[model samples]
Target chain A: MAEMAASGESPEILFWVGCAGSFDDRYKAVTQAFVKILNKVGVSFAVLGPEEACTGDPARRAGNEFLFQMQAVANIQVMNGYNVKKVVTACPHCFNTIKNEYPALGGEYEVIHHSQFLQQLINEGKVALKGGGEFKGKKITFHDSCYLGRANDVYEAPREVIKALDVELVEMKRCRTKGLCCGAGGAQMFKEPEEGKKDINIERTEEALSTGASAIAVGCPFCLTMMSDGVKNKEREHDVKVYDLAEMIAKDMGI
Target chain B: MSILPQLIFLLVFAVAGYILYKRVSYLRRNIFLGHKEDRNDMKEQRWKTMVLVALGQKKMFKRLGPAFLHLLIYVAFIVINLEVLEFIIDGLSGQHRIFAPFLGGVYAVAMNIFEFLAIAVLVSCFAFLIRRNIMKVDRLAMKELKGWPALDANLILIIEIVLMFAILTMNATDQILAERGVDKYLAVEGLFFSGLIQPLFQGMSEGALIFLERFAWWFHIVGILAFAIYVTYSKHLHIFLAFPNTWYSNLQPKGEMKNMSEVTNEVNMMLGIQTETSNDPPAEIGRFGAKDVNDLSWVNIMNAYSCTECGRCTAECPANITGKKLSPRKIMMDVRDRAEEVGKSIDSGGPGLEDGKSLLGDYTTKEEINACTSCNACVEACPVNIDPLSIILQMRRYVAMEESGSPAQWNAMFQNMETSFSPWKFAPTDRFNWADQLKNEEAK
Candidate 1:
């Protein structure tokens, strides 16, 4: 944001590298993959770098509305200072909160989740998949993130991106509107599971495993983490791989 | 036809009316214990909601079998109450069948209809009893339904059956007396179901028949009054509250969370968008969210009263299905129970209870609330539109802001968010590191 202000010009889009994309070791690969695609396609984009905040989704959801508003206001001020308009994020939590919740806080932008942004790019012929390279004929199942699927109603964008990979996309029985949570939504990622018969992620992962897919594709970083953990719990990490849509796209593109 | 009978009738009616009035006033007072909120906007939509959901039973039909049975009882309960007006007049005037002479044939038609509804009510009540006791539907068998909730359901069914039988018996014996050409019997026709039961009075003499008829009449009237008073205390309060509850249902889009204006004002002030008024007194920035029923919005407290305890919300909850301790039905039950406890304490003592117990610790556990995902499934499944999520959020607010009792990892995340502008401990300067690597690859 300071760079844009110093240059006296804003980029075409602002890439919101959310917390997981910014810091988590595994999800950083996803961030790099998506960034590679954007750079290769020559889409003008800039990052907030030190200016970006967590979007306060977890704070608001954990019942600290005061903390959430504080965080949200700070971010909004920085973005508005930079005259930012459009935003693309790899995290559905950021996508949902920014697109839906931030407007009421006086920060409105044409926010798109990375899957939807990538699909738009592919449709416009900016990014091509090199004849469905690498993932051709592989059995892949897509895990729907709750915020993206049930909350915001964007079930197709990620699937469409996966379809571009030319993989045989298998679906869990509880996909789309009936999709189960990865046990990390509503700030549950920040807390230990209360007493229950089984962890929700384990149950959701079992459904994905039941499909007999060799790989599980995800759109949100939180789902990626939960699904990865579930696969490891079953000792099937060696058998099945988990990849974000961007990672799979970058791999297929050989970028 | 004596003044003595009239005096007895007035005394019984006054006692029942007074009890019902006291209960209603108590409920109103208890609900007002919560903070005020304005749900008065969207008048047209509110009316539509009342008619469609409460009157039309829109949400009830998701399960066809139970829906039809419920409709039978619901319709009977409503249609039978129309006869209560006639009961009032007859009791006060010491007259039998006062409207019969005026309407003549139409009176018989109405009686036939009432008799049919009485039979429907009886049959439906019996079916409900079997479902509650014998079949034991999963929603009805939740742990919260143990003891009084279980007995309350069965007792209501039994009372309905008894009340309907009393109506039938009174009508049946009245028909037999009219056959014997007794004065004031009126020889009313087309009694339908009651006519069928008239044979049970075949061997009785006039005086015995008169005694049985009066006994049934008193039982039916008195039972109706007692049921009215009992309803205020039961989950069956939904019978009265469903209309107002549905009328005031949240009209906002399901995904939109309610914004805190106080926080927004503070934010705006920080952003230089608004200036604070200098002359205003120091504002009481009380606890951030709800710690007790008094801190909650009045609509939330009313929602507690409107819960049917049918466990439909719990049945549809993902957390409950996945074996979490969170039960939306139980949450509402706990709120109502806590409200009752607080209300009773205040009634005995003064304005506030000296008891250290609160709605949070004594009634609901933190584990149950934390298990919730805020999925809105419970909100969607509620027949009366009770929002358990709102109450959960409020209680969680108390936990997070006032108590500072969030789990350890949450505290870490909160600290990270406070300093780093993200949930991770990494400095925000590295936020664009991933994008920079892409440019580095391009340079190579």
Candidate 2:
């Protein structure tokens, strides 16, 4: 945000590189993949870089409303100072909090999840889906993230992006409104499970595996982590691969 | 009219009225334990919600079978109470069939309709009893429904069935008495269900028929009074509370969380968006989130009182399905129980506010609260629109801010968010490094 203000030039959109995108080793690949897609399409977008803060989704969800408001206020102040109007984020938590919660704190922006944004770029003929991609005709199932699918009601955009890859899309028994959580929401990603009969991620991953798909597609970073960990736990990491929707699109483009 | 029976009737009625008043007052005081919140906005929408949800049984019909059965009891319970007004007047004035002379044929029509509903109520109560006991529905068998809740459900169903039977038997015996030309016995016909059972009293002595008539009459009226007071103590309280609970329901979008203005004001002051006045004293920071019943909003207390303990929320909860400790029904039950405890302490002139126990520690544990995913499934599944998530969030606030008892991993995340502006130890300058890598790869 500061870089844009000092340069006296504005990008068409601001890419919100959330905490996981910025630092988590596994999700950093997703960040790189989404960036490649943006560059390939020649879309003008800038990152907050050192000026960005966590959107406080985890803090607020974990019951620290005070900390959440503080973090939200700081980020809103910086973004407002830059006159930032549009934002696109790969993380649904950030997408949800900023799009829904930030407006009450005086920070309003036209926020879009990366899946929807990618679909829009394709719809506008800005990005082309080349035939014979790596996932062409491959069986891929999508796991709906609680925040993205249930909370925000964006079920079709990510699936549409997968369809654009020329891949056969399968679905788990519990999809869309009835989709089970990946057990990583509500800040549970930062803590240990509190003594359950079975881990929720394992149960959800079992449903994904039952679809006989070779790859799982995800829209949110938290779902990616949980689904990937579930695949690893089942020792099917060799058989099944978990790819974020952006990564599959980037790989298919040969970027 | 005999003065002796009239005086006896007055004494019995006063005792029941006193008991009913005491229980209702107790409930009112317990509900007021929480802090005030204004849910009076959007009056038109609130009225529509109450009518559709509580009156029309809109949400209940999601499952057709249970909805049909519950509607039978709900409709009968409401319509049959109209008969109670006639009973009160007849019992006090020593009159038999007082409305019979005024309405003439309409009186028999109304009584016929009441008889049919009485049978429907009896059948529905039996079906519900079997569902709770013999069939053993899975939701009814959850851990939260054990002991008192389980027994309370069976007890109420049995009482309702008995009350309906009393009505039928009273009408049947009165028909027999009228046939024999007994005094003060109106020869009313078209009694439907009761008329079918009139043969059981045939060939019996007149004195025995009159005795049975008076017994069933007194039992029906007195039983209704007891049921009224008992409802205040049981989960059946939803019969009365579901209306107002639906009225004060949250009208915001399901995904939107209500922002705490107190925290917002502090944030605005810190951000220099709103300057604090020099005359204003430093704001005293209270406990961050709710710690007890008194800290929660009044709507939350109302939600607690309005919970039906049906376990539908728990049945749909992903956490419960995955075997987590969290049961949304249990959370509401615990809140109501704690509120009752605090209210009773106050009635006894003891330390009510400082009961040395709280809704957080003594009742609900952190394990259950943490197990929640905040998915809003429970809130959506509730027929009365009770938002268990609100209470869960507030209790979690207490755990996070007041006790600082969150897991070490969460504390690390909090620390990371504090210094690095992210939930990681990396510097924010490296945030866009992924884009830089993409540019280099493309240049190749």
Candidate 3:
């Protein structure tokens, strides 16, 4: 973004590499997969790189409104400095915070989740899927992130993208608006869950496993990590794989 | 004189009306004790939401069987209440079937429809009771509903059944008297449900039939008045509040937590940034989040009262489903409990919120609030759009901001977020380090 601004040219969109997409070892792959799709499609997107900051979603949700505003204001200033108008992110947390919460704080943009962006790219015929990818004919379950599904009502876009892979989409008993949480929301990823009969991720993963799907697709970085941890807990990691929708799309497109 | 019965009816009606008014006024006063919020925007969307959710029972259809049963009761509640208007007029005027004279045959048809609705209400109430007691539906049978909530659920159903019986019995005896050519018994026709039981009164004499019919009449009307008063104190308050609650629902996306403009101004002033200009003075930042009921918004308090305690929220709650302490239903119940406690205290000329107890420690626990994943399944599951998550978030805010007593791990994450831009301890320069692998993949 800084280089583009220096050259007096703005990219088509600013890729908001959220904290998970940037720093988390596992989610970084989701970031890379999505970027590969973007590059292959020639979308001319630029990341904030070092200039990006947390959207204060976790802090705000944790009830530290002061910290949340500080982070939101700082991120807003940086994005506004770049004249950033459109944003796309793989993390539903960042997407929700920026799209819904930022407008009240003087930051507004056409924010799109990577799943929606992928759906748009596919509809426009920018990204094409192979006729017979490794996932074709195999059963895959899509876990709805609370932020993306119930929060924004973006249930269909992600499912449409998954169906484009030519894989049979199996739904958990609890799916769409009634989808179970992976238990990483509201800063639960940073801390241990309260004592319970079972971890939420395990509960969610069991639902996914019940569908007999070989792959569990997710839209949020937090969900990806939690579902992956859940698969490991069940020792089904060797058979069942958890992935972000972007990663699956990128792999299907052979990007 | 015949006016004697009229006088008794008037006295009962006035007393019940006054009691209901007092209860309603107390509820309104307690709700307003919470801080104000501007939900008046988006009149069109608010109307649509109220119509669809509260009026149309849209969300209830997510579960077909219960939704069907609930719809029967809901429809009966609305249509049968039209008869209450007639009952009120008859009670005050010392007349029997006042509307009967006005509409003639139309009145009998209306009466038949009302009878059918009464039977529907009876059937629905019976099904609900069976589901609660015999079937032991997990959601309704949860530990949160072990006491008054459980009794309250059964009591409302039993009352509705008894009320329906009163209506049916009143119609049956009135039909019997009209058959015997008694005066003022007003002839009616096509009363299906009540007519089915009319034969039981065939052998009764005139005086006995009149007494039984009059007894049922008083019972039906007085039972309705008492039910109206009792509803204000019960979860059945949802019948009245569901409209306003759905109208004033948070129209924004479910994931969007409310922004604190007060915090925004403070942050701007501290950083020397120009805040948005407004003629009104900067609002005071009272205790950060809600310590008690008063610190929350009026809509939040209304949400508490509007909750029907159906346990749909608790049933779908991820935390509660996993055996965690956080039942979203319990959160609303706690807020309502605390508000009622404070309201009663102030009424008695005692310290209200300063009674050495808070909603946090005394009513709801930090364990319960902390257990929430903010998954919003509970919010989505609410038929009337009661947002228990908002109350949970407010309590969480109180814990974090006022007490600075978030769990130690959360405090560490807060510290890390303060120093670095992220929740982890990584430097900002390394934020895009993950993208470096993209260039290597491109090289391949």
Candidate 4:
């Protein structure tokens, strides 16, 4: 990480802190904490400034391609000049856009979601975790993000790492590769959900609740917001908590 | 049977049939097989489309009116051909002019009408050729070939006209000297062909005219045989493929999406396409995701071969008119090319693989598929009745179900479908919240 930062040859991941991660400093801190762990293991990484503009995926979904492209090209050029060989982001949307969409417009780079990167780290023994935590013996079901699960096919790593950490990985009726969306993709976060039968995130949260887990564990920062809101709207906040994977992982590491 | 004549006909057509098969199959193999897509639902659509589409000409009125007019001539050709068959069998039964009188008496007018249509068909086909080649006029419905496509297409068109004209000439000449009196339409037959035919026969008496009629009979038969071969190689290839494509079209569901099944023997299992793995598919599949072209399946080629390129499919496509960069006609053409490519590879000792191409791709593009809004316009507009929408939707299924090649908006749509039975992906609270129990229950 330091070598790339100094020489400027290696591409910085430009990990967008995102609204959710920024608001929940604990998640942010843990995400940063994990980077330190990765750094110690000699896995190279970096962060874009905290105020880096939103990828505007939400704006694009609101039928505003101009805004989306503006945000996307700006980030792409920043990363392009850096010789970015790859980018890893905690957000599935950012990871996918940087990997799949940006390249279509002539920006090419190997982009992977953080779950994928984290899973690679864990699988390679570059990162390890201790299991004991404040939320011990609590059954939690993981909510797969559309960007990560369906879009990117990072089905196993999050569960594998979570399993290693001693979380009672409860399975929802719909989980893994075919997991539901959190209603947060397509710049949906910036606009009101289409007037429909139900909120997409809440529907997913109910499935997680149906799993009988004490908490809904999630991978995407946006999913964390949606599911947490779902718990509150459904008056289940007292019964089931929403935690980003980082927060749970940090707690297990005695952070 | 006169082994000599039969052998000559068989020999002519067999060589011709092989060439025709090679050409059509080449188009089926090379042209359609250029790209691949995932169309798992196409297995059933194969039957539905073939029956309702290729044979029924469901979209003929919706598109391809002029082509359909030409097709009507072709159909009349087939019907009138039964009369020709009746004569050949009569000849096989050792009679040349057996039905000559009855045909002259009863169906002469019908024969004359068919002849007129055949002539009109020839004219239209010629005009069409001029438009396609010289004028470079192209239907959004059919493939735009190379600037003046190889001589094969023009030759095929010429052959069709010549064969029809041969029938016209032979029929007219035979009627002139037949025991059934010369046809009234043969005005000045003597002034035109009498002198033309006389020089060919030295010291010919009136009885020699019978021999001339026999010669014309053989010539016309040869023309038919040649036409048979011409059709094999040309877009007229649709003559054969359309029937079967229509007969077996609705083999699968179009609107309802079947669940994805895990087949253990991936080695033996078939997918939507049977062709290339899209080294390059359409722009739609290419943009978001496309694995390879080999995954499209057998049915897409059936669509290509059966399509007459009547512009109906495109005329009805909502996406095409709404400024979306999509044309159902182009999609069919691409499918045909990609299909032909794959089929050719298989014939050339390449594996006839039906596997692993993305239904949605950066090649064919998510934008094009997403532009559909599933309006069924193209399906409704097909002439040989192609169901491109079924294939398009199945592409969506592959992306949504298998590859996650979906656009950003669909990500939420799938999420909604997962949470709620409806595509709305509704909240659980509101999912049933809109419902109220039957209050009266028949006044109970």
Q: How well is candidate 3 docked (DockQ)?
A: 0.85
Q: What is the interface RMSD of candidate 2, in Å?
A: 1.5
Candidate 4, residues B207-285: lDDT per residue as tens digits? Answer: 5655566676676676676677666545566777776656545433222222211221121122222323346433442
Model 2: per-residue Cα lDDT over A216-251, one tens digit each: 999888899999999999999999999998999888
Candidate 2 residue runs with Cα over 4 Å from true position: A1-3, A32-44, A115-142, A149-177, A211-217, A236-255, B3-15, B92-113, B179-190, B264-285
Best-matching candidate per DockQ: 3
The global Cα lDDT (0 to 1) of model 3 is: 0.90
Q: Place model 1 in a CAPRI quality band.
A: acceptable
Candidate 3 collision pairs: none
List the global CA lDDT of all models.
0.86, 0.88, 0.90, 0.56
- Across A115-173, the per-residue lDDT of candidate 3 in tens digits comes to 99999999998888894999999999999999999999999999999999999999999
Candidate 3: tens digits of C-alpha lDDT, residues B1-444: 458888988899889889988999999999998998999999999999999999999999999999998998888888888988988888888777888888988998898888888888888899899999999999989888889999999999999999899899999999888887888887787788898998898788889988888888888888888899999999889998999999999998999898877788778776678866799876777888888998999999999999989899998888888989999999999999999999999999999988999898998999999988888999999999989889889888888988999988888889989998899999989987886677676678
Sort order, DockQ high to low = 3, 2, 1, 4
Rank list by TM-score: 3, 2, 1, 4
What value does the lDDT take at residue A1 in candidate 4? 33
In CAPRI terms, where does candidate 4 land? incorrect
- What candidate 1 gets wrong by more than 4 Å, as runs, is A1-15, A25-47, A85-90, A109-179, A207-219, A235-255, B3-7, B95-113, B186-191, B263-279, B440-444
Model 2 chain B worst lDDT window (10 residues): B275-284
Candidate number with greatest lDDT: 3
Q: How far is each candidate from the true structure, as Cα RMSD in Å?
A: 4.1, 3.4, 1.4, 20.8
DockQ of 4: 0.01
